[model samples]
Target: MSAAIRNYALVTGAYWGFTLTDGALRMLVLLHFHALGYSAFEIALLFILYEVAGIVTNLVGGWLAQARGLRFTLFAGLALQIASLTALSLTNPDWLPALSVAYVMGLQAASGVAKDLTKMSSKSAIKVLVPANADGALFRWVALLTGSKNALKGVGFFMGGALLSWLGFSGALLAMAAGLALTLIAVAISLGSAMAGPAGGIKPKFRDVFSRDRKINVLSAARLFLFGSRDIWFVVGLPVFLASELGWSHIEVGSYMALWVIGYGFIQAIAPKMLRAKTREPDGRTAQIWIAVLIAVSAAIAAAITHDIAPELAVLGGLLVFGIVFAINSSLHSYLILAYAEGDKVAMNVGFYYMSNAIGRLTGTVLSGVAYLYGGLVGCLVTSIAFLTLAWVISAALPSRSGASTQS
Candidate 1:
């Protein structure tokens, strides 16, 4: 195959594999912890550990990608991922629960490193493959791949759930480890034949690492608010509304998540056309503004659906609407990054995007937990409205689409 095709295929395949491993681990471990009698707070804490790992490695990965070149970073990330998974698979009986969480944390950190590195590297490679003015096209391609990654992750979750039911946690973990090993092999082969940069000899100072690219920093700020509201909608708010108020089973809820993911992927599959059309329009900023609004409206609808309407139908309906908003948000994020970020700092931009999201989730989850305790579903609705309004205001501070100023 041609060079461009080879690089895209390799990178896409590698992402698919990594996402599958991540999905399996997340689904299996949550159930395992629940079965081991961990409380909701403990479960959240474990996930928090994983997020912490991601936050640290995300920055490191960005710096490494900038200095070490794409191939080296990618290889190192894959190796670390494999080692972490193997260690998780081999944890002793006494360390079952404790080691399990630790193992997952390592995996998440390694995966974060790999993902951020690969993305930055791929962006560089893709830029060379496509013409300079075709950034819009590049955005569509990357968005489609991202949507595919989510779809594969959902499938992995579904499969993992089924496997966990049959093989138990240890069995599922072992199987996941084996799969991850194979994926690492695939990435290695792709790297061998792919056109990649020599590790840049640039040794960045601490100051440079900490310095925020003005454009990415602003985009990260918008993303933070967006995700903060999303956490309320997803983790605390959605689960409570579905289970306690609507009377859905956990399995049913899981199914709905998978369905939401499928719908998310479907919309993303067509995101290229959407991006193309929006690129031509004058209301890019207006459409971007509506993202937070739609999310807020969806939250309101969820509250309404649970109050007087059919609970189950309301959730399904809310999910469908949320899916559309999510797609738009995802595309807008990529567009903003490509439009404004410097070419060399894609990893930093992506890392900050996720780091902002992590902070948003941490804050939102805490507040939503409080809401769950004090006001039940209504509290969640209130929190959604409040935070989403703030998000709207924050988005207005973002640089408008007139190709205007991109302040940090």
Candidate 2:
């Protein structure tokens, strides 16, 4: 394989491993702590630091990666994750509730920082490695990377439950740490003397990561609400509903969510062909249209629950449609960010975009518990609709075409 392809494989593989553990860690914490009688809001609080840290991590990690090289950021992220896992594994179940919460939140913050660092490194590499003039290749490659990463994350969700069952919480965490450690070692050895992506050589000022480009700024706004809409319902409401009302076991809830995410990822992988990006790339107009459709789907789900139809059937069926449609939206946004990114500062640009993403997740994560506690799934879906509406409004401002201020 060519050096570019080989390095891309290594970066993708490393992030795949990181994402697996990241997904599993989320499941393990949610399920284990909930089983320990943590309230939904309290459970949500545990993750607050995780999302909060991502906000800072993505913004700064991008600059660090650009200044120090992608390899530096990637390795630092991997090490931090391993440390976070190992530290969390030592949680003492007998501790006071407040103490336990504090401990886990601190570790989760570490994991969050690790996650953004690794993500910014891997994703920024794509624009650097893929030729800008290669018609349609960038979109296809981005879809594959993003889709496959989500698919593995779904598997990790299932694995989390399985591991928790087979080996208690501490055991499951340790196992994941061990596996990730091996992954880190492999990447470190294989990538010796090779740069994962071009580094700026000079440190970017903090303010420099903030993009002023209209297309990028507009797209970032749209992306914020787009992800917020998904997580507002997806994070706490869905699995909690499946478990509490549906009376499903932890494993069953995990498995169903795994299935949903797997299917979603599948659609994303094929989105390039499905959306006909080869014939014409998706633009701001496309994003607006798709978000509108998603709003309708979300509203239908909310209405079905309100009217007390076969609520489960309606939710399940409607969600399948939502996943397929959302995947297209997500895949489009993923490609657009890279397309709009200024070439010279790809890492910084990607970082700033994801900072907005982290903010949205923070909003959704908080609202997931609040909305679900008050109105259950219906409340969550309604809130999601509101977020999507905002996204559609914001996307209306996106440039209708695909030429960006690119750098080589």
Q: Pick by lDDT: which candidate is best?
A: 2
The residue-level lDDT of candidate 2 at 121 comes to: 86
- What are the TM-scores, per candidate, against the unseen true structure? 0.86, 0.93
- In angstroms, give how far residue 408 of model 1 lies from its true place: 16
Top model by TM-score, which number?
2
Residue-by-residue lDDT tens digits, candidate 2, 1-408: 877778888889999999999989998999999999999778878888999999999889877777777888989999999999999999987999999999999999999999999988888888877755667878887898899989988988888878999999999999999999999999999977665444545666778878878788888888889999999999889988889887889768768889898888889999999988887877788889999999999999888889998988888899899999999999999999998887778788899899999999988988988999998999999999999999999998988877532342
- TM-score of predicted structure 2: 0.93
Q: lDDT scores for all predictions?
A: 0.64, 0.88
Model 1, 1-408: lDDT tens digits are 866667777777776777777777778767777877867776666666555555555566656666665666666665666665666656444666666566666555655555545555554444334345442556566666768877887887887788789877777777777777787787777567453453234555534555366546766776676767766757777787778877889988888887778678767667767656436522237445667656566665756665767656666776687778777776666555554555555445554566676677777777777887887766676676676666666666565653511221
Candidate 2 global Cα RMSD: 2.3
Q: What global local distance difference test value does model 1 have?
A: 0.64
Among residues 3 or more apart in sequence or in different chains, the pairs in candidate 1 whose N, CA or C atoms overlap within 3 Å are none
